[model samples]
Target: METVTISPKYQVVIPKSVRRQLRLVPGQKVQVIAFGDRIEFIPLKPARELRGMLRGLDTTFEREREDRA
Candidate 1:
């Protein structure tokens, strides 16, 4: 895991390796989520770009016949 130091201005620079791996570009928006004791940065993708992202995935699920109504 790459470690980063938080600057005195409360900003942290993402490591070059991590940034390149994630294809992160300057000025790109990211959502910061605080879960438990860790933080997660989720890239904000355009809705159109998310189209067909789950193509051919297993969507089958068991359900009672009555539930179909």
Candidate 2:
């Protein structure tokens, strides 16, 4: 695993290998989420680029009786 130190300005530089592997560009945006203790960085994609990403996903599920109508 690669380690990075947060700079005095509260910024951390993502390593080169990690950047290349994730195909991250110089100005790409990422969503920063914090849960419990650790943080997660998720790359944000444009809506147009997200087209048909869930194709063939199982979307059918049983509904409750009262909600079925």
Highest lDDT, which number? 1
Give me the displacement of residue 67 in model 2, in angstroms.
1.6
Q: Which stretches of candidate 1 lie over 4 Å from their true place?
A: 58-69
Candidate 1 — number of clashing residue pairs? Answer: 0
lDDT of candidate 2 over 1-69, digit per residue (tens):
899998999999999999999889988899999988988899888899889999999988998899956
- What is each predicted model's overall lDDT from 0 to 1? 0.94, 0.91
Which pairs in model 2 have colliding backbones? none
Cα deviation at 19, candidate 2, in Å, is 0.8
At residue 66, candidate 1 shows an lDDT of: 94
Candidate 1 residue-wise lDDT, 34-54, digit = tens: 999999999898899899999
lDDT of 1 at 20: 96
